[model samples]
Target: MKQNITDLSVLELSNLIKSKSISCTEVTDSFLRHIDDLNPQINAFCDIFHESAVRDAKLADAAIAQGHYSSPLHGIPIGLKDLTPTSGSTTTFGSKLFKTNMPEHDAILVERLRKKGAIIVGKTNTPEFGHKGVTDNLIFGKTRNPWNLTKVAGGSSGGSAAAVAARMVPIAEGSDGAGSIRIPAALCGVVGFKPSFGRIPDVAGPFSSTTPFFHNGPISRNVHDSFIFYRAMAGEDHRDPFSIPTNSSQPTKPLPPLNRLKIAYSRKLDYFQVSADVENCLDATIARLSNLGYQVEEVDLGLGLDVEECFMTLWRFKLSSTYGGLKKNELHLLEPTVQQLISEGNKITPAKYGRAIKVRERVWDIISRLFSNYDFLVCPTTSVPAFDIDKESPRRINGIEINSLIGWFLTYPFNLTGNPAISLPVGFCTSGLPVGMQVIGQRLDDTRLLQFSETIELENQWRS
Candidate 1:
């Protein structure tokens, strides 16, 4: 009967529930208390399902009392990113137009969660349609960082990252098209895992079917909970053509031996200029991992990765293809930034988008060759630490101009490469703000990534 159980990892809580040390109702109540008290300031949740969550918790407790256990996630509370739809819950997608949107059925991932008996706590906020890097949206205002409420939590999975960092929920679902999960995780000081594309099947809305960039992943305070939650939701779904069978690719594989690891550590990944504070912090983390005999070495990507042109071209095309066709009258419903993005997207030529696709393939080839020699690749997750919540994004970095809101992020290139990447809280800046180091694994080798990440986590002792 710990009074402050909100901080316990999901695995610990699951064990407690199994042993009857704490009823599911009690677990639910502890988090609800935190949500009621902290959520007002964090703005992490757009909707909190207190009544339904309690009902579900009681059901979970009764199941356990009857000598039954659904899964490790049973009785564990988690938040679904607003981009995902859950039956009987508002799937706002963090948009004003969909403010009253409620889906008749849960997304495939949500259905899997219910099967695992996870308690659905609420919907975490996101940028409308997960458009930008920063988390603020017109529908529900902004989600602030828990580490320092004045600083912005990176997005479009901003709410999920903030909620996990704030301990509003032990785990929250996050979607990444272009560093949506890793960006927020880095800013908020949490573990955000974006499994290799297709590892977790997405809802695959019309536009989603057209691209392979979007991913459904997990955000949490630790590696163990993330891997567990990922296993529960990861499997083939008929609805998602891109879905991979869990049996064919076990994300639960054991960690490889440390002596066998040949990791590539890059400070800037070749193009971005990392802030002085962030660079210093990453240098310390790399040194620590080096001393631990991880066989790490610094290497430049050499791939001319101001990849903004190719990536953003595809981004605009994706946006235009997805939102450009929406009825003209409905355009007013979007936030101004998103509306502007859609407008720019509509202007992209088919010729330009095609060239960008070719560039993406070339980028993947380069990364693939590098992975052939390295067990893992590491770098600072974002070039800068968390910025002000009031601004759209850092307009400049190291006195140089940034092309877009996401220009400062180092996590997006991996998104383009379809690699399993993660953000682990490594160190804090002079102002006490957290900095994250990104690690990417071979394509479809998520298990190895988590194993290596666990090693790094143990070495660094990351705390939000």
Candidate 2:
């Protein structure tokens, strides 16, 4: 039985290509046709390399004919988040200042993908410097949600998530400094995986390379496909100051039976208001997990309200440092909000940053205890569903007045602690907006978490 080319998984496509069941050009053409048909409304891509993609596809076919297949990603058409630089492509990082900026070489992750025989389709849209929780940027406009055009796709990796969700591409590259990848994956009903901070290298990260919280990972419609893509992109890269040196030399392994596994679930780390839709979806998931015989208990890590301040402090400091390098004359080209955020960042003194680090250390210490007794922690990816495109986050969650839009997110804490977290499509809200359930693992336990995610994915049958 032949499956629809557009419906095939990345691994499935690779297998077909290897077996001569389908040619690389045919697969590339199928995706390009979808890109032409869908990208106009979705705005998922900042640039399109249709001609190059076809050229590469033909080459991929020739390589396979001669038995030179590079990896599972060979001939796979993939999108790079605009924040990622490719040798010949303009990577705008969703800002005006770098709209014309072209790098001398592909970012380390891009090089990794190319070495695996993956075809660089084009650049996906992203917010300026991937600063905010949403996807709108001053340079490339906005990326609309494929599920609901009027709503947001969740961002900084919004375009990558949207592209995967729309079937324009089976997989794409995305980074999560603070939930950039997972947030959108939840909204688009795709799988977003943030491997441990250094599991994937950011040797050419647009912002400061020293920040451990910033991470690179993959986004796909399913966990298994993402596993294949991530393995190709992850490894030790000495150029990246934070890249991990651990020998994770093998592919992800399968999970054992779930009967003895324990997953601790938390609704809110403390007591932030949650929308009814998110709560209901979580409640049902909890019930389902309980029925599956996994020990699911409700617990809190006590991350504290001050943790938000700590995260924001570190984030702003990083952004402020990145913008400080801009030539004074070129400063005017930046987005106003970015300017404001950087201004706030500049105001943070070293003393204040040190204080924030103390709070972060406290969080790491307190949360580390949870792992002693539980294998994983499950939580809502976002406090609310995808809100209005032009706005920040929902003004209120569960009728409680929310102050900052980032306040509704639960992803940053993990980034601060350098833990591995993944967002899977658990279900949807009454409004048809997708709700994601986050599964976090201990540091360096990415393979286990991925196997766990695949278990849930098989049980839930989640797909766009």
Candidate 3:
């Protein structure tokens, strides 16, 4: 039987389109139809532009017929997290405050994706202002895991991850701040790559110049697909001053054999709590790496339990500084979690924020030292599998009280240190939900990270 268009990877679909064996319209229709059938229950997308998507796909088909193949993303249907602004489209940052807000220009990544011939299908849902780790908001409700409806899809890229997991799109744009992209990718059993800071120019909207922890990235079912998106979006734009100005994304050297690579493994990043099933899956993954002839050794990161405290300090301040100017009525319209964040941000003194910066430097020192000895660091992406969709985050893990905000998150430290990290769906929990294994590389070494992840993807053949 011929495989469904929606089931094929981005490269597969691109080949089919490039060869004229299948038109872009057919592929777009397949995905739109699939979205029509599945999106109601999954609630992965807050907006679906059926007419414009078909129009764009038809344009792509016309271009391909004229012998124009833009890139691997050509003619592919992709979802943008609602937080990503699209010119002339309603780009609600998952908050009612911006429900009708439309931008006059696309975000740098969005512009790049379009220039590469990728069609934007619609905007995926996200938590209000993407302030939390769960995908629930006043505007779009909650996005549920495609693996299990009762479980969350993860956030703030939850909608993008869920859309990719459900095969509604082969790949989608996701942003990571405290693992927003990686968190959802892990929960939805997809690949999410958080490139080293500024690998992808993020110049637009309120965050155009303010934050460094936040990253614009990609989510897909496999590493190769994510790599394609990364290459298309990576590179410096004059607009984002922090954007890395180099051709470092292109790999210059071939990868060394797996046997020659040393991988550092940590089950828990110090004080984080992980559930039993996730722990088991993580152990099995490490053993698989060992059996693959890779030297995998357990290590104590010694990041200390207070890591989350410092992270929250920086996060809250960012939130407060960004949205603290809202009028009283506007504040009430914001998500309670976001309002709380702004309130918390107000309490953060300049000295406390300064301390957080010092803590970030410490994190960088520790992770940098680890990378000096090991080629990569591997760990569970999230401390637990998907949890209840309605809750902001789990109050406890393994029956122990944890911080409700980001306590279960194991991804923020890398974000803090601006390391390149990718999440691959390694295995499943006892309850049949997926578990992700995170791979971290030295700063600005995104190319090597993708190569390593592709190796593992080939070995394990993970798919949503």
Candidate 4:
């Protein structure tokens, strides 16, 4: 019975809890038990709040008995990325420097989730300051993929992705500066959604930038569960100056039916070397969409200028500015890669940074115009499948060398453009590792993108 609860989606669990078919205490206990048994192998959680979660579960049961009902997430166990602050909980961002740091107030998203009756079970692990795509830090160690423990689980949201894939939790919060959520979701065989910039409130912190390039969104096993969590965490917040005012009337508008759609599929965007397995999987996905009455065409996204150079400059600048005030001793505790990036950022002159910003805006303008002709853009989430956990980055993809971190981060451009993107499991590689297809929509069209993803999943029957 406990095993059965672990398989249920957030919507499914919510229905059972509402109908009294399962008590909140039962659901919480089931998750807690699973985490206790499995977390040792996966390293998905940095800290567990078992006692507080049990107490919250009991309170939920009492409310249900008294005829009080909360939001759809009531009593569902969820994990928080250690980057988000949780009042009274040790919210280490996968760093030894702040291992004992605890916040007196919850982050805006955490406060919203608590109000909606979701019980946070623990803080999931992340790379130090979420600086890299792989989830390993000097403090909490590495988070292994549930499917194949030896392979890497994409990060900085690796722990959240692993937890969802392993059924330790139904949903989790993940922040994406550049494919952090989507990369792990692809590797872990789960659903990852990055809502348009400013759609979800982002609380400011040492790593947070005033620019709306970074976003916090939900990662779940299914589309509806992601939607439910997204709706709950979204809306205007005075604390985040970039948060947009969501019009209630807009959500009520019926989604435009996705029939006879035009999809632009790019296997290798501007000569990007892709793995044969990923190419084959993407071809199959395009066929499926065509069978569902859509037009799929091979399009070339001629993005002028060095996109990697521009994005990295901006990214490193943000990191440097965000953490520039740390003491030298505290800085020494950071990962070597992080320290290297800070040094590079420190060397970037203001004039060079300004030029990079302008280049980003020009690229966005071009991509936006391209979307006007196509309903959505499609590409492989990553150029290659999950690699060995011990390797820092893949040395080669399809026999081509990848020299730097940004070389493998093909999905970062969309993040820079603030487009709504989702990574859906398409197929697996010969190594038995998962491959994912990225469905990208224009900014502020998150709901439509989600609806289209549901169509794709249903047509392909892609369930883990």
Candidate 5:
């Protein structure tokens, strides 16, 4: 069977474009056509740039013809999350209030990708202010999971994950404030990597500058593609004081072999309730790792229930700080969750907020100690698979009611600790939904994490 151009991975398409076996225009057209055919059904894209994409593709081909190859992303079609501001393009942030808002300059990551010859086809949908786990907004509606349209695509990066899963785009950018990248990647059955905080410069104004839990990352069908995106987006920028002060050049130091690494895993993180199907899939993954000569062990991560409360407190605080002033004037325009968050956040005293910060440090201490003993930590990415798109999240997992937006996800802790984490599709649930296993590495050790994920990818051949 002849492979579809849209089905090719980022590296495969890059190879073809570099070899002149395919033109950038041909690749861009194929993806734009696929998006046209699928976006309406899934609501994955909020903005489509047909003319701009074509022009950029032609420019990429021209550069290649002149024997100037920029990087692996040269001539590749990619999608940016709607929250990412792009110059001269509508960046709604998935809210009606900003429906017509357009930035005068591209985000730091967008600038880097464009310089490397990546063609932005459109802006993918996200939740209003990216405030929740599922992707739906008053402006763009909900994004459906490509696996099963009846189920949610997960968010706030739901659109990026769906586009990659449906083969509309081989790679897309995602931001994770609280599992926005990994949550949807797990639900959509693609690879989403949240590098250690500051690895990718997130110069998104005051809100992004002070947040320790937020990170910008990549979503794709495979680990190598995610790595390619990571390499391009990582580097120091004087504007982002938190940005890592490291060169983004390809690393020459080799990572340790996977077989020699020590891995610690928790089925439910010692507190959250996990569904039977997700637990079954994770168990199978542990068995596979054991068979592959990995030293895998189950451990009790003594993260008290206070961790969840502290995370929510900080999340609400961030939201209120950014949008509190609008509550008195534009509250009607904001989504119900965002309004509620802003309301609750305004009531928190400085003392309460400071106490939450203290808990955050304690949580980090627990995670840092675990990393000192183990090379990696693994767990179920989410407690359940993709659920009904109509609701924000499953009302319950294993019959325990989920009261919070990001509670069902097992990804937020890593975000809080500033560790690198990647979600790999492990298998599927009986309901025909995909299951994901999250692999977490120590902070700032992104290269080792990527190499480990690639090794596991080759072993499972999950895409097969």
Candidate 6:
């Protein structure tokens, strides 16, 4: 039972702890042991709060004994992405610039996690300032994939996904600006969920992005744990004007049988090139859904604007505006890739920025109306499967050139539309890397999408 505790899902662990069948200390120790053994190879953690986690676990046990349960996540060990602020803990955004920085208070979401009695075990790694989709940063080095140590773990939430996949933690917090959460989850073979915009608050800090598309969410081994963590961190916070009021009492219903549902499936978003493996995996997944009784049809979402140009224009401008005030030394501290983006952003005039926003709004208007006819949409999370850790970006997909960062990120459009999207590990490639299917639901239909994901997960019996 002790040996198996570390493998249990967050829901299972909560049940065990609540039933007194297991102590929080025992659960924490089991995870600690797993991290100790696996983390050296994966480099998933920047720091491990072994003592603090054990102490908190003991306190959770005492509270349970006294008939006081904090929340669903009580006593569960979790890891925070280093970008999320943690009071007194080293919260480097995988950058040398913040090596000595510590926050005086936890972010609003972190405070909520604490209120729910979750024991934060450590901080996961990210790219410097989460600038790119890979997790290597100057501060704590790179976070490698657990499936194959030599391969790259998709980032900037790479460390979080790797930790969850390697069973270092049952669940971990991850922030996604442009497929940061889903990308890593796809590569590391776990579940990554990015809820609707404003579903989770982005706390006030230097690392926080002003763009509505940026979000903080969760990465976990399974859908149920993802749901649990999402619930724990969601709700309105005065700290973030964008935070939405949540109805916790709203029940999540299982998805209607696939035969009763209409889904729009597309490999390429009209013009983007999809790798052969990605194309095959998506094709097989669509067929599987059809077999399970879903009406799967190929449809092109004529996203009128050049998605890459529009997204990069906006993304770069936001980064430049946010970090432009830094001194020369601070600017030089940024990675070359990030520095290049900032420079590009600086060149965009205010008129161009406004036009980009207009383009985004128009695109969202088109996609939302399309969702009216379909229950959900499906696509490949990335244009290609996991690539070499050293390569900044794959030059081509299925022998077609990928023009820019957003071209490789096929999943960011939904984020721009403020819709809830999830990445489910559907199959593995010939190289043994995992393939993920993006399950996107209509705006504010997060619960339905998650329930559908669980059904698909069960039907396919996909285990990582």
Report how far off residue 60 is in candidate 6 (Å).
0.7
Candidate 5 residue 240 Cα shift, in angstroms, is 0.5
| lDDT head-to-head 5 vs 6, winner | 5
Q: What TM-score does model 5 achieve against the real structure?
A: 0.97
Residue lDDT tens for model 1, 1-464: 54479989999999988889889999999898899999999899999999999999999998998999989899999999999989898998888888999899889889989989999999998988898888878878899999888889989999999999998999999999888999999999999999988788877573454354888899999998999999998988777777788776334556557767899988888888789999999999988887877788789776675377888777777777778888877998887877888899889887988888887887798899998899899999998888888765777889988765777888777778889999999999888999999999998888888988998998897752
Give me the displacement of residue 47 in model 1, in angstroms: 0.4
Instruction: Point out the higher-scoring one by TM-score: 2 or 3.
Output: 3
| Cα TM-score per model | 0.96, 0.96, 0.97, 0.96, 0.97, 0.96
Report lDDT (CA) for all predictions.
0.87, 0.86, 0.88, 0.86, 0.90, 0.85
The runs of at least 3 residues in candidate 6 whose Cα sits more than 4 Å from the true structure, single-residue gaps closed, are 204-212, 248-257
lDDT of 2 by residue, 16-52 (tens): 8888889989999999999999999999998999899
* RMSD in Å for all candidates: 1.7, 2.0, 1.7, 1.8, 1.7, 1.9
Residue 202 of model 6, lDDT score:
83
Write model 5 residue lDDT over 298-396, tens digit each, in one string: 999889778888888888888888888884557889988889999999899999888888988987898899988998899999999999876656767
Q: What lDDT is reached at residue 330 by model 2? A: 76
**Could you give candidate 4's per-residue lDDT for residues 184-219 as a string of tens digits?**
999999999999988888855523543427778999
lDDT of 2 at 459: 78
TM-score of decoy 2 = 0.96
- Candidate 3 lDDT over 261-319, as tens digits, reads 99999989877898888999989888888998999999998798667878888888888
**Residue clash pairs of candidate 5:** none
Model 3 poorest 10 in a row by lDDT = 203-212
**RMSD in Å for model 2:** 2.0
* Model 4 pairs in collision: none
